[model samples]
Target: MGIEREIKLALPPEQADAADRFFSGIAGTPGRDVPLVNIYFDTPALALAGQKVALRLRKTPDGWLQTLKAAGSVQGGLHSRHEWETSVPGEALDFVALEHACDDAAALAALRAAASELGERFRTAFVRRLWQFEFDGARIEAAIDRGEVTAQVSGQTRREAISEIELELLRGEEPALHALTVRLSAAVAGLTPEDINKAQRGYRLCAQ
Candidate 1:
């Protein structure tokens, strides 16, 4: 499951100007900030339990949108890289609005809380980071320009490093996987995930 969540905010007319100013230089470019909004959905009224395992979506000023995602330690259970972890793996708390950008914008500050308690209950978890690599003719890869994230999982296998480009599309986020897979396979013609057999973000796996 993904940890990042999106939310929309409806700030007061005065707050709008400040919010925009705050996020003016957030993410990559100016006025394009990607601050992780700090909104929490608490669980167990008696106990803080943990950061709500969800995000809060809301609307912002100038018709702009915002999102806040959950963040925390997700331990136990099966890590995708392995299938032998105990139980308990969850997200922290947050609100990330960038996910649903073009959706209806008339509504303001709508929220949805999860049915379970907060706190992480897993052994291992996945996080986000960026890395740079040069693809040699030894392998191949592809990318789909969809809103999906383009995080490439890479590792060193055997004699060469292998990299497999990956993206997360919604359960039914337009363009079926089958159809998209074909296009991706074609685009990644000769790549056999050999670029990154045991490497990711900036970590190395296996006995390298």
Candidate 2:
């Protein structure tokens, strides 16, 4: 499992274009703009959520990827979580690899039991523009996502708009990422720290 350290920021939908323009000239290798559809799963009783675990299947340009993430602490806009992901041909979860990804025996046991009852709860579809940069001795992967999250209910779909900026630390210290955010916030109006993640937002939409 790899630890994920990043900051998530919610952006005004109208400001996305401006942010895109600003990031384009930054020092980094420009990455492809791609679409991503992610389906989040949970048991009927929310067993995994009760234990602070989340499972998802993401459809990207490369292929489907199954990811299992453990709930981690978030302070301000910084988040630190343990994440395990692997490529899969289909949407189904691979229990063996997921179990192997668990850090402890107890977590593995819970995952094993919950796997059988997992079902899709909500989904997020977005177009992501990306770049990888070396800033202040840190390698940060920056992304701008614009799309919507949908939740199905009784044969209908409910949609919520999504526009955010993410800066993930690929290498080096967390402080560098924080420093960059400060700089960007000054240059970009309406840019604020966001503590909620996509999963949490989707869950709230599903509940509504």
Candidate 1 TM-score, C-alpha based: 0.21
CA shift of 50, model 1, Å: 23
Shift of residue 202 alpha carbon in model 1, Å: 5.1
Candidate 1 C-alpha lDDT tens digits along 1-208 = 2331111111233333333333232222233222221122233331222232222222222222223322233212101221111111223223232224323221112223333553221111122122111222111111211111111123323222222233222233223323433443343333222222111211222122
Query: Total backbone clashes of model 1?
Result: 56
Given candidate 2, what's the lDDT at residue 90?
A: 88
Shift of residue 58 alpha carbon in model 2, Å: 0.8
Which regions of candidate 2 deviate over 4 angstroms?
28-31
Once fitted onto the true fold, the runs of candidate 1 whose alpha carbons sit more than 4 angstroms away are 1-164, 171-175, 193-207
165 in model 2: Cα distance from truth in Å? 0.5
Model 2 CA lDDT for position 157: 92
**What is the per-residue lDDT of model 2 for residues 1-208, given as tens digits with 9 covering 90 to 100?**
6899999888988887777766776753455699999999998777887888888999998889988888798988788998888888887878877776667665576678887888998899999999888889999889998898998877889888889999999999988998999888877889888898888888887778
